[model samples]
Target chain A: MSKQELTILGRAADDACCQGLASAPLDEQRAADLAKIFKALGDPVRLRLMSMIASREGGEVCVCELTPAFDLSQPTISHHLKLLRQAGLIDCERRGTWVYYWVLPGVLDRLAGFLAVPHSAKEPV
Target chain B: MSKQELTILGRAADDACCQGLASAPLDEQRAADLAKIFKALGDPVRLRLMSMIASREGGEVCVCELTPAFDLSQPTISHHLKLLRQAGLIDCERRGTWVYYWVLPGVLDRLAGFLAVPHSAKEPV
Candidate 1:
C-alpha cells in the first residue's frame, strides 16, 4: 500500500497536479483525493500532530515521544495518528516497544504544488 | 468583513505564515483558522466549484455560469459557496441578477505557503 501511494504521489507531484486551482479545473477524482487529504487536516489536533511529526529531527518521531505532548489520552492520540496514517499524510513502523511516525513528503509536496501560484499569477497587475 | 480579511491576508502573505508544518508547531488559533478553510474544501462539489471560479478568465465567475456545471440544485451550490465564503477562501458580489465569485489568492497563497517544503528539505540528501 505504501509503495502504491508512493507511485501515486510521484505521478501527482511530477506532472498530474502541479497546477493551482486557478490554472485549470480540477478533475472529479483528483478533487476527491485532494479533499480527503484536506479533510484529514481539518482538525486542530491532527494538524498539530502532523506539524510535530513533520518538524521532528531525523524526519520521524517515536509514538512514546508523541503521546506526552498532547493533553488527551494516549489512546485518543493514537486514534488521531491512525486517521492521519489512513489519509496517506503519514506512515508508521513498529520498532521494538514503540512505533515511529513520519510525514510522507511527496503528499505534502503534491498538495502544496496544487495550491501554488503560477509565476504568471504571482503578482496580479 | 472582506476588508478585514484582506488586511489579515496582506499581513499573512507578508510575514505571519511563511513556513511549512515541518518548520514549526502551528499555534491553536491559526490551526483553527486553517482547519476551517480545509474543512470547507473537504467536499467534492465545493472543491469543483472552487476550481471553476478560480480558473475563470477574469479571475471571477458568475453563479449562472457556476450552477450548470453541477447536477446539484442552485441552492445546494449556494450553500457550499456560503461555506467557502465563510471560510475566507472565496468572496462574491451581487451584481443585478447574478452573483460573481472569485478565489481569494491571499488565502490560497497562505495555505500553499504553510504546506510548502523548506528549501533545505527538498532533496533530503
Candidate 2:
C-alpha cells in the first residue's frame, strides 16, 4: 500500500515540478492527494522523525537509534514512523532485529519545488 | 493573537532559510512551531484557497471571490482563510464589506527554501 501511494505521490510531484502551486490552481483530486503528504508532515513528532532520518550522514538510520532521541515510548515513535512511510516521505526495511529508515530520494526537493513560487509570479503586478 | 503568531512563525522561517530541514536535526521548539504552519496547509480546502490567492494576477483575492469557488459556506471558507493567516502564509484586510487576502511576501519561497535539500546532502555516501 505504501509503495503504491509513493508512486502516486511521485507522479503528483512530477506534475508539480512543471507548474508549482503559484503557477495555477490545483484540481480537487490533486489537492486531496497532496494534502495527505502535507498532513503527514504536520505533526511535531513526525517532522522531527523526518529530520532525524533525512539528516543522517549515511542516508539511513536504525529504529533503535531513532527511539532513543525522543521522550515518547518506542511504540509511539514507531507509529509516527509508520505515518511518514504511509505519506510516501520515507521507506523502511528490516535488517536482523532493527528496522532502518531513509527519506525517499528527492522527495523533499520535489515538495519544495511544488511549493516554490516562480520568479514571474513574484514580480509586482 | 494572530499577528503575534505570524511574527513568531516569520522568525522561525527566517531561521529556517539559513538551514533547511535536511541540514540538521530540528530542535523540539522549532519542529513544533513549523508543524503548525504545515498543519494549516495540510487541508485540501486551505491548499486550494492558497493556490487561488497566490496565483491571482493582481496578487490578492477578495473574500467574495473566494467563496464561490468552493462548495462550502462563506463562513467555512473564512475559517480556512483564518488558519492560513494564523500560519503566516497569508494576510488579509477588511475593505468595507469585503476581506482581501494576499500571500505574505516571499513566504512561499521561504517555506520552499526551508524544505529544499542542500545539494551537498544529496551526494552518495
Candidate 3:
C-alpha cells in the first residue's frame, strides 16, 4: 500500500471507529485494503504460520524456530511468512542468522473491532 | 460442507473458543475451516457485497436493491452472494420475486474474535 493507504488504516485503528460489517458496509478503499489482508490469511499454511508467530514467546518468533515445527521445507515456510509480511499483518528483522517476526500491532485489532457488533445488536433476536 | 463439517463450525462458534491464529498454529481441521471463510472474504467484490449485506438498512437487502449498487451484472452479484452463503457468513430468504440477504450473525463475530490478540499480548512492545 502507499503511505496514504497506510494512513487510512492507521486512522481506523487509532480512532477504533470502524463499524461492524453488519451495521454498515465498508467504503470501497477500506474494503479493498481489508480484502488483501483477508486474502493473505485465506491459506491454511499461512494462517498457521501467522498463529505461531503471533502467539510465540515475547510475541515474536525466528524463522529457524518456526521451520522445524512443520512438515514443509524452510523455503515453503519462508514463502508463507513473506505473504504475511506483505499484507502488513507481521514484520520481521534479521537477528544474526535468523529472521524474527511479530504481529504488527493494531491491524488485527482494527479487524476484530470492525466486525464487533454494536451494543444495540448484541442481544439475541 | 457436510453435517460433520457444519458441526465443527457450530462447535467452534458455540464454544466461542477458537484461539487466535497468532496465538498458536491452527490444527489442520480448524485451519481448513477458517481458510474457507477467509477465502470467501478475499475478493474485492465479495468483500463489498458482504459489507453491504451485513450493514444494510433494516438488517437486510434484496437482490434487486443490491444489483444497482454495483457495475456488475445481476448474475455476478448473485454469484458473490452465493459465495457468502456458502461460507456461512450470510443467508437469504426469498420474498416474492426477490431474495433478501443478511449477515448470519456470530459468524463474523467468530472470525473477528478469532483474530483478536489475547490480553497477555495487548501491550505495545
Candidate 4:
C-alpha cells in the first residue's frame, strides 16, 4: 500500500474500533486483504519462519542462517519466505546474493489488537 | 486431551519457551494440534466470530445474539462456532435453548507470546 493509502486505512480502522465488529463488517475488499495476510500465517513453515525472523537477535536474520535451521530444502524455505514478504508481515533486503528478513513491528500488534479480548475477562475454568 | 495430557503439554510448552522455534521443531503431534487451531482462525467469518465472542461485555455472548450480527445463516454461524470450540479457543455453555460462548484467555496470549518479538524493537519505516 502507498503511504497515503495506508494512513487512510489506519485512520479508518482507528475510527471504527469499538463500534462492535458487524457495526462495520469487514467489507469484501478488506476481508480479502486481511485473508491474504492470515493465509500466509496459516502454514506451520510460515509461522516458524515468522518467529525466527521476529525473535532473532538484532531483530532480523539472514536467509543463509534460516535455511539450515529447517530440515526442508532451501527452495522450500525460500518459497515460505516469499509468502511472508508478500503478507506484509516481514520485509527483506538483499545483501549481495543473500537476503535478510526482519519482522515488521506493530504488524503482529495489529493482529493482536484485532483479536484482543476486553480487559475484563475472568479466569477460564 | 485429558487434564493430565493438557497439563503435560502446557508444562512442556512452558519449559521449551525461547529455545527458539527450531531449538525444537514443533514435534508432529504438537504441530498438527497447533495447525488445527490456526486453521480455524484462517477464515474471515471465524475471525470475526472469535472477535465477537472475545469482545462481548459479559466476557461471553449468547449464540442467538451472535447469529444476527453476521450476514450468515444460523447454521453457518454454528459451524464457525464449532470450529472455534474445536480449536479450544472458546468454550460454550447451554442455557435452555441458548448457548453462550466465552474466550479462553491465555489461548490468545499463547499465540501472542509465540509471535512476540524481543522486548525491544525500534520503529519500522
Candidate 5:
C-alpha cells in the first residue's frame, strides 16, 4: 500500500520540481496529497517514532526495540507506526514474532526537496 | 508572537545541526516544537495558503489578493493564514483594508534542512 502511495507521491513531487512549495502555487489535488503526508507527521509521538526509525543504525529497527523507548503502550506505538507507513515515510516487515521498520529510501529527501525555498524566493538577510 | 516563536524554532534547529531528524533522535521538546509547524501545514487549505504566499513575487501577498483564489470565505482563509502565522512560517501586517503576508525569511529552508536525510543515510540507488 505504501509503495503505491510512494509512487503517487513521487509523481506529485516531480510535478512540482525541486522547490515544490515555494516555486509555484500548489493546485488542490497535489496540496491534498501532500497534506496527508504532512498530517501524519504532525503528531509528536509519530514525529519521535519517525526520528527513531530514520536515525537508527543499520537502517531499520525491530518493533521490540522501539516500544521500550516510549512510555506508551505497544498498541499505541504500533498505531503511530501504521500512520507513518500510510504516509509512505516508513515500511515494515513481520519477522518471526516482531515487525521491523525502516525509513523508505529517498522519501525524506523528497519531502525536503518539496518544502525547500529556492534561493530567489528567499528573503534578503 | 510569531517572531518569538521563530527565535525559539531557530534555536531548536541550530541545536540539531544540519541533519536534524536523520542524524539523531529528536528530544521531546524539539519534536513537539517541530510538530506544531508541520501540523500547521498539514491542512490542504493552509498548505495552499502557504504556497501562495511563499511563491508570490516581491515576497508578499495581500489578504485581498489571496481571498479570491479560493472558494473559501475570507474569514475561513484568514483562519488558515492565522495558523500559518502561529507556526512561524509566515508573518503579516495590516495596511488599511488588507493585510500583507510573506513567508518568514528562512523557515521553509530550516524545515527542509531538518527533514532532509543526509547523504550518508541514503540507501544505495
Candidate 6:
C-alpha cells in the first residue's frame, strides 16, 4: 500500500512545480498537487502543532507529549498530526508504545528557499 | 471596523503567539487568529497568486496580469486575491481601472523568521 505521505514542506522543496507557477500558468495536475500541500498548512491547529513538534526539545517529540499540549482531544491532535505527516513536514516512528514525530528539515528548508527575497531585486514601493 | 486584516505571516512575526505554542499550548483566541492566516495560504490558487505577485517585476503586478496565470475564471482569481489581501500577504491599490497588487514584504519576512531553524539545534533523525 502506498503510504499516505504528508508533504510537510519537505516534499514541497522537491515539488518544484511551484517555481513554474509564477513564470507561467499552472496545469490542472500541478495545481491540484500544489494545492494539497498548501491546504495542509492551512489550519491554525495544525500550524501550531507543526511549530510545537518541529521546535520541540531533542528536535523530535512523541505523540503522548504533543497530545496534552493542546486543549484539543487526542483524536483531534492526532488528526492534525496526520495532516502534517501527510504533508511530509514531519516523520514518525513507533518506539515501544509511543510514536515520536520529528521535523523533516529539508521540507522547511525548501519553503524558506521559496520565500527568500532576492537581495538585488528592487524593493516594491 | 477592526479590519479583518489578514495576517500575511507579516503579523505572525509580531503576533508571537506562535512562539509560545512550541513551549506551551495556544490559547483559544490566538489559535483562531493564527488558523485564519494559515487557512488563507491553504488554497493552491492563492499560494500561486502570492508567488506570482511577490516575485513579479518591479516587486508589484496588477490584477489583470495575475488573472491569466491560472485556468480559473477572473472571479475565482478575484476571490483568491481577496483572501490574500485579507491575510495581508499582498496589498492592492486602485490605479485607474486596473488594481495593482504588491507583495507585503513585512509579512513574508515574519514567516521566514518563524521558519528559521536554530543552527545550534541538532537535526532530527
Which whole-number lDDT from 0 to 100 does residue A67 have in model 1?
A: 86
Q: Write the per-residue lDDT of candidate 3 for residues B1-125, one digit (tens) a residue.
A: 21124445545544334577666677777877787788888887888888787777677888888888888998899888887777777778888887788777678777777888656656555
Candidate 6 docks at the CAPRI level of acceptable
lDDT, candidate 6, B3-120, per-residue tens:
3464434455456423533444455556566566657767778777777776676777888888887788999998888887777677887878988887775666555444555343
Compute the lDDT of residue A123 as modeled in candidate 6.
Answer: 38
TM-score of each: 0.85, 0.93, 0.84, 0.69, 0.89, 0.78
Order the numbered candidates by lDDT, best leading: 2, 5, 1, 3, 6, 4
Q: Top model by DockQ, which number?
A: 2
The docking quality of candidate 4, as DockQ, is: 0.24
Q: Which residue pairs come into collision in candidate 3?
A: A22-B54, A51-B21, A51-B22, A55-B22
Give interface RMSD, per candidate: 1.2, 0.6, 1.3, 3.8, 0.7, 3.3
What tens digits encode model 4's per-residue C-alpha lDDT throughout B1-125?
Answer: 21123443343334333432323345444544555566767787877777667656666788888898778899999988887777667777788887888766567655544443334433333
lDDT of 2 at B30: 91
What is the per-residue lDDT of model 1 for residues A1-125, given as tens digits with 9 covering 90 to 100? 23335445345444535677768888877777767777888887898899888888788999888888878999999999887877778888887887889988667766776776676665666
Which of the predicted structures, 4 or 6, would earn the higher TM-score when compared with the native?
6
**lDDT tens digits by residue: candidate 5, A1-125:** 33546667656656654648978898999998888889988988899889998889888899898899989999999888888887777898887887789998777777888888655545465
**Could you tell me the lDDT of residue A36 within candidate 3?**
75
Tell me the tens digit of each residue's lDDT in model 2 across B1-125: 23647888988887887788888999999999888889988999999999999888888999899999999998899899999998899998888887789999878888888899756656556
Looking at model 3, residue B71 earns an lDDT score of 87
User: Residue-wise lDDT of candidate 3 within A1-125, one digit each (tens)?
Assistant: 21224454455444433466666667777677777778888888887787777777787788888898889998898888877777767778887887788878778877777777765665655
Per-residue lDDT of B1-125 in model 1, one digit per residue for the tens? 24335444344333425666878777766666667777888788888889898878888999899898888998999899888887778888888887888987667767777787666765667
The per-model lDDT (C-alpha) reads 0.75, 0.86, 0.73, 0.61, 0.81, 0.65
Residue B14 lDDT in model 6? 57
lDDT of 4 by residue, A1-125 (tens): 21223343343334333332323345544544555566677777777777667656677699898888778999999999887776666777887887788866567655544444334433343
After superposition, candidate 3 runs with Cα above 4 Å error = A1-17, A120-125, B1-18, B118-125
Off by over 4 Å in 2: A1-4, A120-125, B1-4, B120-125
DockQ comparisons of all candidates to the true complex: 0.74, 0.84, 0.73, 0.24, 0.80, 0.42
